[model samples]
Target chain A: MNELLERGPEIPAGTWDHDWISSVVAKAEEYSGRPSHWNGKLYEQPGDVAGVCLPDGSMTISRKHVLDQARPAYTPGETLTSDQQFAAAEATRMAVFQARHSMSEVGDDSLPGATPLESLEDIALENARCDQFSREYSGRIAESMTDQSLPLVAQAPLFPAYSAATDRLLYTLGGPTGLSHRRLGELIDSTERTQRLNAIADEALDHEVGELVPESHRAELREHLTGPLRRGLGGLTMTEMSELTHPGSKHSWGWDSAEWTEVEFSTNLGDIKAHYESWEAEHPGEEPPELPDSLRETFRDREEEIQQVWASKGWPAQQPVVGREQAYYERLPDHGPVTARDQEIAKLQQFLWSHTAPSQHTDSAVDTGGRPDNVRQIGSARKHGRGVE
Target chain B: MDAYREVQRLYAEAMMSAASGDELVAELGETVQRIGDLLPQTAPGERASVLLMNSSLAERLARLPKETR
Candidate 1:
């Protein structure tokens, strides 16, 4: 009967039969005796036997009431009336158990039995393999998305196992010939390594240029260079500025003037100075005007020459020189004495004023230093002038 | 051991039987057809067959020629 039931389909619902329920209830009764409240209390109701609760609202009981009320043959499988359903469900459950056991025995030769720990280990290993596969697959997918060739170093993590997989793939797909896979891989790896090093060097340079350079020097260098350096300055120090500014120093750094001249039209100071000196030397015969003191001496000599010439020519002269005397006055470096010229002009004006009106003696003769008699006669005439008047 | 060998043999067979095509639409149809062939509804179980179908499809796709894929 077990074989027959086991071979049939599994029961689809859960229910039980009345006979099974009654038998289970009888077993329960046999074990516990008549239903009663297990707890002992002093105020007991008339119909409350030990622990069992009566169906009427008047009686109270213990947990025995709940247990007694349960139908015992409730199993899981078929749906039907209690008696028929319980039988079918019980049969189905027994059939399922037997079927599992028989099938296990039949397949025992093929199945590998493992302890729980061994099963866990196997699962862990499988999970690891799956993770590795997933990682490789994802890496490949990422690599394929771009057409541009990645630097060999950047491509390393994407193809962890093989060194030249990318290059090999490229070569296989009608790439340049005369390129071995190993050589190509090495080339790419070296190229990418170089690129990475260069990038690192660039970043370091930026930091040095931006932060390490002193503010004053940086501003000066900026003005000198006119802009940022295109080729890096190779970590030059401030002390190198002396070498940089020297006339023919190899260490001197600057833009190529010849190259930049087309854009910058201003004449350089060096060129201007050179041209000025060359012009002066070319016209050596032409001298700049003499210093102011030398000019004053020359003017005085010219004045004497003019006076002698005027006397020899008998040109009517307005004033005669009493004496010729050299004059000296201290002056600032660029300007001559202001007070001395003012004093000289005042003396001339006073002399003119004294000579303009004749005294009471009406003598027209000029004062030549040789004429003392003439001066005496004029004096006498002045004394006798009142009587004649 | 026999069940393991059978599983491996069936997997390899399914992988070998997968179709190849030049067009994406054709390849997709071939993939579906191969999966359906490897996983018939009449099989006693569904889980193992479904797994086998998926794995076989993946293997076939991987082995496909670049131009065809």
Candidate 2:
């Protein structure tokens, strides 16, 4: 029995001993029914293949050939290549091998005692458990990585580019060498475990969490956690923009009053009004005119326009708009003639006159209302003259 | 294995089990919290040291207190 087991298989001794490359070529040739060449070298048997080759010199039988060949049986203690799947049967074999080894190493006197047969059975069961865990866990990781509703900012790391403004990390995984979803998931799982254990150590160390974790390890953890965390926080909805900008706040996006100042009439007018009233009270002597309802409505309507104007000019919130307003009026260049019943013109003239402090002129009240009848007759005569022409 | 290695092994295995980004993140969070729990309540600098040593773990830990409670 010992001889039978020991002589199970031979590599057919050759110049090369690396098993993997030999197997790859041997398997390729077996599938193709022709000699296989890798980077211009030939491998006739398992033991003749080199471990590594220059990139340009290696070429194998096409992938199609391998699928046609009979699949090899795998047993525990054997490391599979990266492409090999850990099927249930293989997992069972590995489990059994592990159990037997563990039991033998620990010895019969140890708490569990040696029972190779029973240990093998237990291994089978454990493999099943692990398979289920892997299936469920992989599914979950895939779901999180692919969920699109999680905003570009939050999803940036998981996707491709990392944007500070959006708090997103995104990058393309379509290129060569990018892991498939399953493999990438496995990698994520591996890193995640290290992260958790470190967390536990961090808690234990408390004040010494940073000291406990090496700087390099910390950087790795940061790379892994940053994306998921940014995504998670990106899910939060702020009822108030102020909540975003508060000191030490974790939320990256916030409302700037200037951005919404035009629309403040609708959403934040009450707060603004209260603030204005408070300011007015504090400055007691200055009486500002009450904002008329029409003017307020006009201001509200102009919100979009104001935002566009402000954005175009790159004006700060505190910059006066009076110049812009005057420029706008100047562009129009036409205001109807000033005639009788011009209360506005009269008011303006009276204000101007008061400012001049006329020394000799008697302070006489000007009755501008009487000129409206004469102005109406003149307009009628002009229309009659145009009709005659 | 050393405690750090052991803990890291378990953490990596747990992470592999994570099914989604949320789950992965949650698992990361739990791991950080575990570290936090195990951490000694020494000086702030000491606490920071524990976190800084495992910066990834520390970052996850930092995010948790603000988010979970």
Candidate 3:
């Protein structure tokens, strides 16, 4: 048994099956020992085997040789458990359910039949792979000497840009060099954990009551749960998110604290603090939730729960058949005009930005001294100004 | 009354205002109740909400007082 496995996999306790954890770590260590190489760098498994760089600066490889490469067996951890697999599949199915709407939202309905699912699955894979590595190497990786800035904001095209967003969100590669950027990896890991916690928190709320959201409203309800409802829950740490739903949660996605400690924060700690402060400002009399202090912790004082409550709660019974034409409850991430707040927010920002004319030339240097006694006052005109589109 | 918009705004405010421990539970319950009552009286699409709503409705209704109580 590897030394790490003896501690029984350094992962969130209930997020994955024990055997599955064992297999993933064991396999990861095995792959770490593999000798698959192209030139100086190691291949990211067989699928990454592009042709070697030639002297003429061209690259070439036979599709046959690439496929013929003997890659080791690797099962996706996202689909490792049948239930998670089902949920992921259902998530994609739902995305496809609204594929037309998604295409329309993207302003082109001419996508190939399978593009939506394929793109979503790509996103799913990226998320799962990031989740797996983060879980596998949590806290073990080192800090990156490289820049940790978040990727510039992009609209994330319905299906096409899902990947770019996922890539932007991840820091380390899944290769041996992956665990090198400990801080970045930890941040990505925390993010992945945040999503899981969001899902769990969402499950708790959706299942908390006998929700009679009408079928016509089911999609809207689903969108609500995944969106604002998600933002509502996003404030809490992984532990807090879980414990709210599972009061004595024993699960661990690394960081879990109840006070404001600098070390226990995401790479974007300043932003999170600003967000929390803004949230406080936005909700004037409401008490803020308990939150963790650290973004990175080398040690944990895990609460011991002798009894396993893994079976205590589950997600709302999701059905892919709820959608019109049996579409899923919500469109995939890249789908059509989001009837939700996300789309509204985007449009609102665009309107605000377009209307403000921040870049419009102002004769501040010209002074208001003798300026426009009658020389076209900037105020009323700009105020009523039909925007310069 | 654009109940959905109202609910979205209020619900967001409520969540932003929530002081831990599912503080919005009561608000959600009332919102659900009001929407259920009002939507049916509002228009045809609203009427569809009354008929087509699913277990999430039941779940929200069930959850309102159960855990918080």
Candidate 2 shows a clash count of 64
lDDT of 2 by residue, A114-136 (tens): 22221211222222222223222
> What order do you get sorting by TM-score, best first?
3, 2, 1
lDDT of 2 at A101: 18
Clashes of each: 15, 64, 36
Taking the candidates in order, what DockQ does each have?
A: 0.01, 0.02, 0.01
Q: Encode model 3's per-residue lDDT on A129-174: one tens digit a residue.
A: 3333333332222111112121212211111111222333233122
Which ranges in model 1 have alpha carbons more than 4 Å from their true place? A1-128, A131-389, B1-10, B14-32, B38-49, B62-66
Residue-level error in angstroms, candidate 1, position B60: 4.0
Looking at model 3, residue A302 earns an lDDT score of: 10
Q: Pick the candidate with the highest lDDT.
A: 2
Q: State the iRMSD of every prediction, in order shown.
A: 38.7, 25.3, 21.3
After superposition, candidate 3 runs with Cα above 4 Å error = A1-389, B1-3, B14-25, B37-69
On a 0 to 100 scale, what is the lDDT of residue B57 in model 2? 30
TM-score of each: 0.13, 0.14, 0.20
Cα shift from native, residue A69, model 1 (Å): 40
